[model samples]
Target: METSLETVALFSLKLAYEEEGLSPILRDDLVMGDYQKDVFELLVRRGDVETIQFKLNQCLGLAMDALGGAEKPLGRELRKLSADFGEVRSMEQLNQPLLALKGYLKDIL
Candidate 1:
């Protein structure tokens, strides 16, 4: 779950910030400090679903903007999935939506 969360953040950052001449954002990059696997591990260990979702929402929001927001088809679907993710209220319900978002982000990239 932590890995999936990290992957989603990484993919979202790649979509939001990666450019032709700029360096790509890797998981170990300083920019990822807040969204890194260890950060997520701690969140998971404490069962802090709200903070986890908040972190993911930050990245996903950027990714949605990069995808051209709700006006675009892909962005619309991303919005829907993100809404679904936002609806998750417990750790047990996190995996499905998290994986779905991760997979969508990966596919778009």
Candidate 2:
């Protein structure tokens, strides 16, 4: 089985790509924090508001340890994402999607 950490990382990458389309440079920038400020802009334009919010929570939870140590703007975006989506009434509503992602991550990892 894939670990939750790996699953979340892969999902983040996939979601990022889906929102922004394929761009190696952009992907590299995202991974390196070079494009942190614009990460959500594409998602917003694509009408992926929910996925963006979900991704923010996933990234935050996955990197909480590292985020505490790194001073990257991604951390701030994640915080904003959490605030935007944190009010959802049922986390269980996301369980199915997250589970599917977990399976995919497990397979790849």
Candidate 3:
């Protein structure tokens, strides 16, 4: 779960910030401070699904705009996946949607 969360953050940041001829933001980059694996670990440890969803939503929302907004096909698909994330009601129910969202974001990048 932590890994998936970190992947979502990393890919979202890449979608929003990466550019040609520039160094990409790696896992240990300072920009990942708030969305790091350990942060997700802590949230998971406490069963804080709401906070986890909030954090992921933050990145996904930026990613939506980065993809050219909801009118665009990719952005529309991203919006649908993000809505799935919002439907999670428990930590146990989170894995499937999180993985789906992560996979989509990674593929698009």
Candidate 4:
């Protein structure tokens, strides 16, 4: 299917919040930095995939950190998500792994 950065961003947001239950507290503590939120808004408003990917990686790292020291599998999953997100250069290129990551998150969350 045809997609834009906003499509990906919205999907990521929904998957993260709705599916993964990324509450305000989790966001305040782990993700949702000002820069990351702005980058996400840029993606939605301007379709700037490049800028948001970096921010996404940052949030992923923070989320990983919030998982604490013992959950190796969750940490690995977030790492894989970060790696896969880093590879997205175009809308077409993003679909497979984004969907895969959603499925993975389904199992995890």
Query: What is each predicted model's overall lDDT from 0 to 1?
Result: 0.94, 0.45, 0.92, 0.52
Q: Model 1: which ten-residue window has the lowest total lDDT?
A: 22-31
Against the true structure, what is each candidate's TM-score? 0.96, 0.30, 0.97, 0.52
Per-candidate clashes, comma-separated: 0, 0, 0, 0
lDDT of 2: 0.45
lDDT of 3 at 54: 96
Off by over 4 Å in 4: 1-41, 69-71
Candidate 2 per-residue C-alpha lDDT over 24-107 given as tens digits, one digit per residue, 9 for 90 to 100: 333345463522435544644465646554655655465433444225565455444444345544443434444544453334
Q: Candidate 3's error at 50, in angstroms? A: 0.5
> What digit string (tens of lDDT, one per residue) describes model 4 on residues 1-109?
2232233333344444553434433333332344444445556456566766665555455556655422687767767766887888875565677566555544554
Clashing pairs in 3: none
The top-ranked prediction according to lDDT is: 1
Compared with the true structure, what per-residue lDDT tens digits does model 3 show for residues 13-91? 8898888799988989888899999999999999999999999888888888899999999999999989998999999
Q: How would you order the candidates by TM-score, starting with the best?
A: 3, 1, 4, 2
Clashes of 1: 0
Lowest summed lDDT window (length 10), candidate 3: 56-65
Model 2, backbone clash pairs (residues 3+ apart or across chains), number: 0
Q: Which segments of candidate 1 are over 4 A away from where they belong?
A: none
List ranges where model 2 is wrong by over 4 Å. 1-30, 33-35, 66-84, 88-109
Candidate 2, residue 107: the lDDT equals: 46
Superior by TM-score: candidate 1 or candidate 2:
1
